[model samples]
Target: MKRTTFLLVFGVILSFSQAQLDTGGEETGGEEEHVELFTTPATKMGAATSDFGYNLFRALASQEAATNVFLAPISVSAALTQLSMGGSEQAQRQLFRALRYHTLQDPQLHNTLKDLLASVRTPGKGLSTAARIYLSRRLRPKQDFFGLVEQQYGVRPKALSGGPKDVTEINNWVSQETGGKVQRLLTKPLPRNSGVNTVSAAYFKGKWVTRFGQSGAMENFQVDGGVPVRIPMMQQDNYPVKMGADSDLSCTIVQIQMQDDVSMFVFLPDEVTSNMTLLEESLTAEFVQDLSMTLLPAQVFLSLPALRLSYSTDLLPLLSDLGLSDWLADTDLDKISTQSAKLASLNHKVAMETVPEGNQYPSAASSAHLSYRVDRPFLYLIRDESSGALLFIGRVVNPKDLMI
Candidate 1:
């Protein structure tokens, strides 16, 4: 939706710890299949085409099914945007299949997907004949999302909402459920006296198995919007870089490949005076599919800031700018929200802050979470390791407010 609302929702739903396998793999001491949960959530939330999107979808689907999460809480919005941009209903189904595939992430998680799908895609919701059958056929009956939620997060919704609840109770429950990392969500001032209108909060934390160095921190890296700011620029020289171009945009991505041909392609906006959207919009499925055939490596510097930031913005305007007028329109986006839905306007505030747990460099032997800072705006995606299908996509303009 709007930038602020997106951040606020992100802060609310994703306030969990560094994502880990949800009890379904030997790697993490579970019986379920072991799949690496990357920093990127799998689906490139708003992107229609990108190498990361294509490759991620194929790789994860082929190897192990995946489930993608979009913090925007506006799947319909995202779906509508894609549809308006020529993404068909079939494309939306494929998106759901890939996203619902997260069952492979963990058995419990998978079961959750199964139950949710079954519950929501019932027979009488005006679904087309084909759509009803497709929904029924695609989902499993034994899967229960509540089970997965309990197994993964150690709490149940029933316990959280034991009695009749008000807005304040819901916010408190979320805060307590997420270990106090989230607060003031749908509530007024948190901490009883902070007096800050705690609209919403989301948190995500991840670490590189192989951390980077902190000694070479630099400053004055010009971020988006031509603004020079002080940041700890983590630099890696001689790293492999893949560059490609399409009718839409030219791009450079770092390919982090894993077992069975799965890869995570990171695309950064090429430095320019205008903005990063030029580079991002130009990236598309055809372009990435073309590049996948001929990925060449070039030595380059990967500089990232080591900083924690919090930001606030009004996103109604931004969402409108991004072609999501349907949601902001007075019609109330009737496609998704029914007359019974109780939620008010979706406003969001997100913050991301990370500290180096150990030394910042590999040679020096440290554990540092690679936190990205986009004073302007940046996009990221997770691609299938093998087929180059996109699993998840997201963007951040003001990284400071991200509760990582």
Candidate 2:
């Protein structure tokens, strides 16, 4: 398989609602308790959504090998799932299949998602997610569907004013929800004939648990095609990280801790020119969870680039490629409105930035001999340690290509 210079970044947040699911009883203790925590509906839903996130990333990456790709899988899945509530049984089935949630028949999926979203939006986590549904003024949503969406998804369907003001209002909502990290999500107004449109946005700006030292002079970052560009590189000596090598994927994996129980995992190929097709295919929720548990901890001299990447794009084509073309074109959402309504558009925007900031001071020289330098294209993901949810997944083919 041909390799592509790719970076996958995923983030997970702790679940605040897990405790509510626990029966009020004496301690089951030890391994059993651990199993219980992982088996919660919310956690399972998180895994399912994470799998969807990986698949979505694959679809986007295949379209353009050189361009960077970023997305908040949870946000997209949340929006689609919420919309599914207003869809016919067949429509629900189709959407579920696309989301890799066909096998999950639990009725608590929405409830679980609500809890998950709450946990994801917990203050001080440096991460936020928002999803909303916009309807054409001519379509009046059924009372039941409107109430369900608001109750479960925490968002009420808003009627589009069918003017430029609609665009501004939607953009303003997204900006406010994401702490202003994402602005003008919709540069132009939606099509006048658009029936139902969904928007999702996620923002993250996390501080490392151990901050990197001051950035050194500009360094040469090797791009995919042997091209190099000067960029600021953050350096830290004796940085505590979980580092390992995956022989199957032919890449070096490193896990750096961030605040709020979030960890950023970076997958660096053995060579800058190495292909990442295999690694990309190997990514799944189960694989990531297993890998996270198996890595060994060590202190290494770490060199990483300061990254600020913002990506916004219409996901209709990508979702269509993921077996949702029919759903996008036409679907039975009769529950939402007496008149026929189909998904008109699906838009997603995400922003992520990593600076040299950290919770602790840098350590002095250590007894470690290994060095991990991310000077080339790689894959990274941010994962929440508590819920095991993937908050963000992205690839950086070239830092310069994504700087904004």
TM-score for candidate 2: 0.88
Q: Model 2 segments beyond 4 Å from truth?
A: 1-38, 365-367
Candidate 1 off by > 4 Å: 1-168, 176-180, 187-202, 223-227, 240-248, 256-265, 278-294, 297-299, 307-343, 347-377, 382-404
Candidate lDDT values, in order: 0.33, 0.80
What is the C-alpha lDDT profile of model 2 across 1-404, one tens digit per residue?
A: 11222122211111221242143223432345434545767778878889899989888888766567888898999888888999889998989998878755677777887888888777756788889988887887788988889877778888787989999999999999888889889999999868899999999988889998767547888887767988888988888887667666778898899988889999998877535677788887767776666455667788998888889988878987779878777789989888998788889999988889887986676434668889888889998877888998877777877755
What does the lDDT read for residue 228 in candidate 2?
A: 93
Model 1's alpha-carbon lDDT is 0.33
Give the local distance difference test score of model 2.
Answer: 0.80
TM-score against native, each model: 0.43, 0.88
Residue 2 CA error for candidate 1 (Å)? 28
Q: Which candidate is the best by TM-score?
A: 2
lDDT of 1 by residue, 64-158 (tens): 21121123222222222222212234433433343333222342433342333232223321110000000111122222432433453233222
